[model samples]
Target: MRGVVMHAPGDVRTEELEMPVILEPTDAIIRVTATCICGSDLWPYRGAEAIRAGGQRMGHEYIGVVESVGGEVARIRPGDHVVGSFVASDNTCEICAAGYQSRCVHQVMMGSVGTQAQYARIPLADGTLVVTPGELPADLIPSLLAASDVLGTGWFAAVAAEAGPGKTVAVVGDGAVGLLGVLAAKQLGAERVIAMSRHADRQALARRFGATDIVTERGEEGAARIKELTGGLGAHSTIEAVGTQESMEQAIRATRAGGHVGFVGVSHDVALDGAEVFFSSVHLHGGPAPVRRFLPELVDLIFQRRIDPGAVFDLTLSIEDAAEGYRAMDERRATKVLLTTD
Candidate 1:
């Protein structure tokens, strides 16, 4: 089988690799139908996250038909069309029971090494894969795929930010996750959602996702815009989807005292001051999103055609062109890139 491998910074190649098979009682093998490049994947592609000398596999978001399942995997069966979580978890753990499946004791990150391939071995099959109701149209495939990561991550950010009726929610960052954060906030009943975006294209989509306003600013300027929108107190809730020091600080500063800040960006080179955060009086919570916790609802929403998060995917490529997909996203030429097994 062919899969994507990273040789070094900015070097991604689709090459022949061994196919995966079930190696654990809870495992399942999936024939990947659709996969994509994630913003987090850029960490390694850009050298922010080290890539070892020999090539390492890439990709973590995938939706596919189950080709096989281990004896202990009862919930998911062969031939089922499933969306696998980026983080695998045994749904039975205490943390999983509390809805934080991302922190499950048995959690294993898919694609940290690679899922951008013909097939993948998914550990904790029962807990990580959500089988869709039935076969879907080709057009809906991309939307369903987004539920595996960005959509789910944005939803978690909204929930963590406490977005709801009468709340003013502000989304920091204009990436796919931030765009979806706008959608999630609106769906969660936020009366006013502010999207802090400098890109015109992203700003337009943010509005389509129910953003009441767009702030074309950054850093302190961006924080001031949010405050101005909120009558000098800042937003009641803020979703930080870019895991950068500037984005983190912007999220914290854009929320009113006693408000909540849900951050879902893959934090890199970020350090928060304890005293500053404590004085800000903003509630902060985020990490690898517990996508499994919201999978059922998100899947239902996609199946019903109530939301189309797939619009974020502005570029598509054959699996063999995975490197181009990564370059498109890394250079910001594409908001999100989708790869199909063709």
Candidate 2:
């Protein structure tokens, strides 16, 4: 099988690799139908995160057909079309029962397994994989794939931010996740959605996704703009989809007192001021999104064609061109890139 490997920062290649098999009783193997590059992948690609001694496998988001299942797997069976969370969890743990599957006791980080390939192994199959209602049309595949991670993460951000009817929500990033966060906020009944973005294209898409306003300014200015838009009280809720010192601070500062801030961006070197947060009076709740908790609902939404989260993937490439997909994202030429295994 061929898979994507990162030899070093800025060096991604498609290489022939050994096929994965069901190594655990709960494991399942799938023939990857589609996978995509993630913003988090750029951390290692840009040298912000250190790579291991050996080449690192890339990608976590995937949707595929089950090739085989281990003896313990029950709900998921071979030949099932499935989508799974980026973090594989037993789904039966106490933490998972509490709806935090991302931190499941027996969690497996799928990034280490690399779904950007022809085939891959999925741990905790019965708990991690969600089978679609039936065979899906080709057009719905991209949206279903998005549900595996970005859509679920964005939805989680919106939920954590407490977005609901009559709430004024502000999103602090314009990436795919951020853009989808806008969609999630609107879907969750936010009366007004403000998208902070400098890019015209992203702003247009944000509007299409239900962003009632756009703020091009970033950092303090962005926060000030958000406050100004809300008559100096700030937004009722804020979603921080970019994990940065500036973005995080902006999100906190842009939210009103007693509001909520749901941060889902992979934190890099972010540091917070104790005094500021202490005074902000905002509820902060977010981490690796428990995508598994929302997979079933999101998959149903995709199956019903209620949301087109796949619009974020402006670029698509064959798996062999995975390097170019990475480059396009790094260069800001594409909002998101989808890599096809076929």
Candidate 3:
């Protein structure tokens, strides 16, 4: 089977490798139908993070058909089309049972497990996979796959930020996760949603997703703009999707006192101003998006046509063109890239 291999910094290749087989009692093998590049995949690709392992696959977001299952797997069967959460979690565990599957004690990181391939070996099948309702319309697959990661991340961010009716919400990024945050905020009943974005194309979609305002400035200026749009009180809830220090600070500073800041961006060595944050009385919370917790609900939304997140995918390429997809994202020529395998 062919898979993506990250050999080193600024180096990724589409190459042939042995297909993964069922290795554990709780495992299931999935024939990946669609997969895509994620922002998190950029960390190591740009040399921002060290790659301790030379040979490893990239990507975690995917939707596929179940090809086989281990003896312990009883919830799903062969030929089932499904969308899976990035975290390989047993949803019945204590943490998962409490709606924190991203922090599941025995969770497996999909980056290392690698979904950017012809097939994927999934652990905790019953807990991680959500079967699609019957046969899905062909065009809906991309949106369902987005729910597995970016959409889920955005939804989690909105939930953390306390979005609801009569509240003003602000989204601090315009990528796939941030764009979906706009959708999530609207669905959660936020009266006014502000999206900080400069790209005309993304801004247009943000508006379509229910963003009430668009702030073109970044950093301090952006914070002031948000407050100005909110009548000087700032937003009641803010979602941070970019993990950079500037992005995080901008998000914190844009929220009103006693507001909640939902930060879903993968954090770096960021040190927040303790005094400023304390004075704002902002409640900050976010992590690897407990995707497993929302998988079923999000899947149901897809089956029922409640949301369409596939718009974020501006470019689609064959699995073999993974390099061009990465290059397109790196060059800012594409918002998000999708990969398909036969």
Q: Provide the clash count, candidate 1.
A: 2
What local lDDT score does residue 170 receive in model 3, on the 0 to 100 scale? 95
- Using all chains and alpha carbons, the TM-scores for the candidates as numbered come to 0.99, 0.99, 0.98
Q: Write the per-residue lDDT of candidate 1 for residues 1-342, one digit (tens) a residue.
A: 989999999999999999887789999999999999999889988889988669889889999999999999989999999996799999898999999998999999896636899899999999999999998678889999999999999999999999999999999989999999999999999999999998999999999989998888999999998998899999999999999999999999999999999999989999998998999999999998999999999989998899999999999999999988988998899999999987
lDDT of 2 by residue, 1-342 (tens): 999999999999999999998899999999999999999999999999988778999999999999999999999989999999999999998999999999999999999899999999999999999999888689998898898889999999999999999999999999999999999999999999999999999999999989999899999999999999999999999999999999999999999999999999988889899999999999999999999999998888888888999999999999999999999999999989999998
Question: Model 3: runs farther than 4 Å from truth?
Answer: none
- Whose lDDT is greatest here? 2
In order, candidate lDDTs are 0.93, 0.94, 0.91
Name the regions of candidate 2 deviating beyond 4 angstroms: none
Could you tell me the lDDT of residue 1 within candidate 1?
A: 95
- In model 1, what lDDT does residue 330 have? 88
TM accuracy, model 1: 0.99
